[model samples]
Target: MKEWFERERAVHIQFYRRQPVVFVKGEGCYLYDVEGKKYLDMVAGIAAATLGHCHPKFIARVSEQLKKLVHVSNLYYTTPQIELAEKLREITGMDRFFFCNSGAEAVEASLKIARKATGRKKFVAFSGSFHGRTMGALSVTWKEKFRRPFEPLVQPVEFAEFNSVEDLEKKVDEETAAVILEPVQGEAGVYPATKEFINELFRLRDEYNFLVIFDEVQTGFGRTGRWFAKEHYGVKPDIMAMAKAMGSGFPIGGVGVSEEVAEKLEAGEHASTFGGNPLACVASLATIEIIEEEKLVENSEKTGKYLRKRLEELDGIKEVRGMGLMIGAKVENAPGMVSRSLEKGLLVNATSENALRFVPPLIAGREEIDFAVDILSSLK
Candidate 1:
């Protein structure tokens, strides 16, 4: 294994600083390394696997689709693409959609729609919100580490304090094309926006007429145990950027826009070559069906409550905060705790140096949650 890593390092461009073990295969909630050791997958590819790894239905659909047809240009439409779009529209109630290959592309499309519809140059983005990595998306993303190197690049984006109505009001002006935010901030430690904050955005939208955009890449697709996190708050956004789990690990993403906003973009205004390809669209359709048919959203809610209840009872936990499956716990030495949990064959992400973010598979069961808690208890 070391020899294989050395060989790959010698030839390949170094991207991620990966762990020592090479994952060989996965089943449901568990992954096996090359050495045959199994680990419980809490991260779920950053919450992309809506139904868990190698879900029978998911695999069967993708496998069958692959045998039929894979790709054709966007100039021609495919059955899967049309069906997927209709399904998404039915679920989100968004008037129209623009398909894309990934989250960043979806975000880029949202930015274009916002700018074109409002005829405004500047955009108001919240601090600690992660849109994506592309230039347009990165401009709105407000993280120095991700933005510093690409300075003087994408333009006309301003940052505001998340959940601070005063800061939002101060930052947003007539020149602001859109106000983009995550209904629940994911990468910044799973902090949800306050009811007051959401109401403030709606107020701003009504007063300013600036488009409202929800970066629902993480908070969508039942990750928060809700179809979209915004539904919990009862606020509707003009545009919603969706991806991550949209295709259940297949590279697919889309932007949902209101009827008013959707009409602004003409045919030639935007396009993607592989946007609504057959394979990805089929994957997405399969993913959504599995989520609904299996009632995974309800499972997420039940398991989330059970897990949160157990976690909140832990002695060393400072606080447990989140909705449904998107949970974060503040504790002393969170990074160390994560490391210890990894040693015990469980995986989770550290949101802060001291906050543990748990986005386990929506289908994760009672046994899995109990096992996770067992590992967490040992950390204390």
Candidate 2:
């Protein structure tokens, strides 16, 4: 494992602060390092691996699709793509779908669609929000570290205080094309938008004619125990960008648009080569089916409440925020906690300097939750 790490450092880009533990295999809610040390997975690949690693159903479905078809041009039609769209419409209430490869690409498509649909230039976003790393997504994302190196991005993007109606009202107007936000801000420590905030945004949208785009990349696909975060607010967005758990870590994402926005799009305005391919679509379809068949969403809700309750009782925690399995606990030293937790055979990450984030797989049960809480409790 040490030799493999050395070889990787020699060739691979050092963008991410790579962890020392080199995991070689994962199953259910656990991962095994190259040295055969087993660790309980709590991050779930940054909330992307929905079904956990090597889910039997997900693997079988993808393998079946691979045997039949794999890649083709977007110019041609595919059954899996259309079928996935139908399933999403039933869940999300969106009329149209555009496939992509990641959350960043989905946000890019949403930005383009909003700009073209509304014929406006400026956009409105909130503080502590994280859309993605792409240029357009980054423009709306509020973070000095991520934006400092890449200044002069998409122009005229205004940042409002998260869940502040007054600031949102002041920023949104006739010139605004769209307002992009995460219903639950995951990257900046799981800060969820208030009901009043979402209501006011919709009211302003009607008056100003600007679209609303929900960046549900982390909060979607039952991560928040609701299928999508918008359900908690009971408000529908004009455009919704999603990825992460969509394909259970199969590198697939998509943008869901209202019929009005769909009609505004012209041919050749946007496309992707590997987006919505047969294999990716089948993977997503199988994921959705398994989640429903297994009742994982309900499990997430039940287990998440138990986890939050346990965290609230911990002396080290200051506050607990977020819904379902996507949770963040305020700690005095998040980095220290993560490091200590890792040494004790647990996998968690620090979303911010003092906020520890947890987005375990939907399949995680009470036993795993109990074990995880014991590790965290012991650390405290």
Candidate 3:
């Protein structure tokens, strides 16, 4: 394992500050390092593994598809891709969708569709929001550090204070083509938008004729106890970008657009070569089926509340925020807590300087939640 790490460090780009442990295998909500030490996975691949690691059903589905057909390109139609698209439409109530390979690509597609559909130039986003890292997604994402080096990004984007209706009103105008936001901000410490704030966006949309694009990359696929996070507010978006858990651990993403917006996007307007491959499509289908059949969404809501309640009882926790399995607890020393938790055989994320983010798989139950709490309780 040390040799492998050294070789990777020598050749690969240093994009991530990886942990010292080298994970060799995972099952359910647990991962095993190369030394055969087990660790509870609270991060869930940063909330991408909705069905947990190495799920038998997921593996079987992917294996079956690989034996038959894997990649036929978008030039021809395939059953798995169409079936997945239909499933997304059934779940999200959106008329159309475009497949991609990651959350960033989904956001990029939503941005382009918004411009083409509305014929406008400017876009409105909120503070403490993380859409993605690509140029278009980065333009709308908050955080000066990520944007500073990648200057001259996609232009005509404005940022407003998150959850501030007054700030949002002031920033959005007639020239704004779209207003993109996360129903629950993931990387920004799991801040869920207030109902008033989301409602205000719709109010402004009606008046200004701008589109509302919900960036649900982290909050969709039962992460928030709903099919999508926007459902919590009882409002639908003109466009929605989703990925994270859509393919379990497999990489896949998509943008859902309303009929009005879909009509404007013609062929050749956008495409992805490996976006809707058969393997990814089957993986997503299997993941969604498992989430539904196992009643994992309801479990996420119930177990999440229990976990949050437990965290709130901790002495050093300042606040607990978010819904379902996507939770963030503000503590005095988030980085220290994360490091200690890892040392104690638990995997979690220190999102911001003061917040510890928990995004366990939807399959997590009270036992898993209790184990995670035990680790945190020891810190106090």
C-alpha TM-score for every candidate: 0.97, 0.99, 0.99
Q: Rate the local accuracy (lDDT) of all candidates.
A: 0.88, 0.93, 0.93
Which runs in model 3 stand beyond 4 Å of their true positions?
Answer: none
* lDDT of candidate 2 over 1-380, digit per residue (tens): 88988999999898888767898899999999988999999999999999999999999999999999998879899999999999999988889999999999999999999999999999999899888888988898899789879998998999999999999989988999999999999999999999999999999999999999999999999998899999999999999999999999899999999999999999999999999999999999999999999998888899899889988998889999999999999999999999999999999989878999999989998898889889998995
Worst 10 residues of 2 by lDDT: 14-23
Residue-level lDDT of model 1, residues 262-319, one tens digit each, is 8777888999998989999999999999999988888888899988999998889888
Most accurate candidate by lDDT: 2
- Model 2 ranges off by over 4 Å: none
RMSD (Å) per prediction: 1.3, 0.9, 0.9
Give the C-alpha miss distance for residue 15 in model 1, angstroms: 3.2
- The pairs that clash in candidate 1 are none
Write the residue-wise lDDT of candidate 3 on 131-199 in tens digits: 889999999999999998999998799999999999999999989999999999999999999999999
